[model samples]
Target: MIQYLWFDLGYTLVSTNREDVYQKVLERFDVFRNREEIAIAYHRADKLFMREYPGVLGKDSRAFFPWYIGTLNYFLRLSLPIEEVLEVQRDVARECPIQWKAFDGAKMTLRHLRSLGYRLGLISNWDESARAVLARNGLDEELDEIVISSEVGIEKPNPDIFRMALSQANVTASESLYIGDNYYDDVVGCQKVGMHCLLINAYGNRGVEELSYHPIITGIQDVAAYLGHPRVQLEINR
Candidate 1:
């Protein structure tokens, strides 16, 4: 029944490891914080920032570096200026690659799904840089629709964003299967609007807790197959 496939860009389609990015930037910039301390501090600040502005922030946990640096300056007892914090943000954005490494099975999976005649689209809680990543990975040309939080002025877990994506894809919630890594944003959001949802739990992130929703996979390849592919061997025989 799935007419369209909505892929979440950050963790589901392309990848970005915040800890890896932070370490890369720190080393590249000659920043003093070691890996472990930097990792903890970054996570703490990120949690605080997300709690503050979930819609305004993004999937890149390190995107709040400017505000985090400014806040931490007051807490760490360092007399750093705002200009220095700005410098840090600029440095990170430039030095850190914001690299895009597509999931292992992504390319082949997309081709297989398209061959089955399923419409492909993207919905992401990301910024404009996502287009570059998609272009590099060849998704920009493949997807029929693309939506980003920054472009839409709303982040995930919000029904309005899902509505926007469905509108562009020319399909109702009932006809779409949206897949993403985050439970609340991906699963709960689309489910509220009557759209089917799947959690691409690449890290098996459900932990030990029981989930209210069932049917998840560790990769986009699973969703692609579920929606339309049904294995190339089956198609070849037909």
Candidate 2:
């Protein structure tokens, strides 16, 4: 029986769909921009950084904020100070809070799982302030454990993060399951360390087509029923 559950943050617990976040940023900046246009701009900025900051980006491929700011600066063609870029980062984080809301059925599933006495933990490739986002969304108090790449200096697919979560959860890898969106990062990741896993794919990920091993969920609610929890039938009033 599974006793512990580790979850991916982006696209799992929270929805960081670039288009959704871009719309909020445009609104906050008063730019009067189209969401598609803004997303393209975001891509341009990141493409520049990947070509430029090879060293930094090489070491940390999941440097989300850096890629975000770099892409913004490059696309906007503005030469703002890194500190100013950071201010914009903080502003986007705070003002665009809705971009990071729990998925349609996530909060209720988490609450139900918690009620069932299952140990829930979060593992994400996020910065030091990830805890703050989790706190803002009220997911912090609900989780029994957390492992962030920025804090631990190691990232997912590395297994060290899972090891740490194992230490905190006091369970064996075989006794736990990890749920994430990314194919390589979440599914292959936790599995590399011998943990059973699930991939939460809302978009019907095509990359998983060849993978023969893991179960996939289109929504977090599916996981509750898969867990065999009869209380999983409760509706999420959101």
Candidate 3:
């Protein structure tokens, strides 16, 4: 009975090309950290930043860079000037949109869902760059609406953003399905708003079969079969 489908952007629709991003950082910025060092520092900082701003959405550069850079500096144990850190942050912000790529079958899955008459939209905890990334990857036009954390000033793991997305689509909570990669943000958030959610454990890294309020899918293409589409059944059998 779902009439609307809303998806999370990062790790769901498209993911950052971390290797490329790391290479760019090393080449463009003056840093002594090796690739492995940077990777660990980056993940630690990223996780900390997400924790700090769980329900606030905006561009990472503008809203979350300060804390991220601080964490990076600590991890690297380097006393970088604020200006240098800001410069690096800006570079990351600029490069991410260009480097992000949609997952295989993402567009096909979205188009398939649209053809089924289920309204498609995006609910992301990202900044303005997401629009460009989506447009560049041919996903922007396919969505009926996009609610970003930066634009709405509310982030995932908060029911208000889910409410906003539903309001924009004019769909009731019970009539919508929210899909995302993060358990706390997508599943917990949407469930709080009384909406059904599906987790996208793309690599099966979660090691979880199900949640109390939602199920899990390995890919967007699998969503078709989950929804009982005959075409998807054929695809699955093949």
Candidate 4:
């Protein structure tokens, strides 16, 4: 029996609207890079940041802020001094809490699952700011546990974080279901720990095709259908 359902945060239960945040920050410095350019730079920055910083973020916001500024400066190639870039980064960080929000069906779906006797938890690659965001959106009360990468000192796709989550949930991997939007981190990460998993493709964004072993939902609301619950007869319309 499925005793627990763990979810990924950023694109799973919550929507970051990162592009808006990026745009707002960039505008402060009069940087007019097009969306495509920003996307390319941000992607490059992410790879480098993950490789270098790993799980240092979230443990202490003070340390990560500089790393974030450096990453942005490197990608944007703004040639600004460290101080100038740091100022921009600080501003961006301050605005992030207001930017993150829960998706439309996230709370309702979690509540529904809880009512059906499934314990709910969260395992995300985020930091302490996640606490405030969850609390602000009232999602904190819906979760039984929250394991963050910064707090746990391990990031997803590493398998160790997944193991940590399972340990916290007090359930074996086989008896839990992990859901997230990221293909590698959420799907492959949980699969590494032998957990059943699902991917949420909210925007209908396409990149990775579904494998025979991979089950997917177009939105969080469709989770009940995937669970085969008697009362919630929704379908995966995608």
The global Cα lDDT (0 to 1) of model 3 is 0.74
Estimate candidate 4's alpha-carbon lDDT, on a 0 to 1 scale. Answer: 0.74
Tens digits of per-residue lDDT, candidate 4, 1-238, equal: 7889999887678765555666667787787777656655655554454446554533565767666766776777776566766576568868674377787757878888999999999999886687888898799999999998777878888999989888877899989999887666778789888999988764343334333446778777877778887544433233
Q: Output the worst ten-in-a-row residue range by lDDT, candidate 3.
A: 229-238
> What tens-digit string does per-residue lDDT give for candidate 3 at 1-238?
9899999998788866664564565456565566667655655554455446554333435675566667777866776676765676567758574378887668878888888988999998887787998998999989998999888998888899999998888999999988887776888899899998888864453323333545777777777678888444223211
lDDT of each: 0.69, 0.70, 0.74, 0.74
The clash count of every prediction, one per candidate, is 0, 1, 4, 0
lDDT of 2 by residue, 182-205 (tens): 666667678788998887755453
C-alpha RMSD for every candidate: 6.8, 6.3, 5.8, 5.8
> How many residue pairs of model 2 clash at the backbone?
1
Candidate 1 lDDT score at position 136: 89
TM-score of each: 0.67, 0.67, 0.67, 0.66
Candidate 1 residue runs with Cα over 4 Å from true position: 17-98, 208-210, 228-238
Q: Which ten residues in a row have the lowest lDDT in candidate 2?
A: 49-58
Off by over 4 Å in 2: 20-98, 231-238
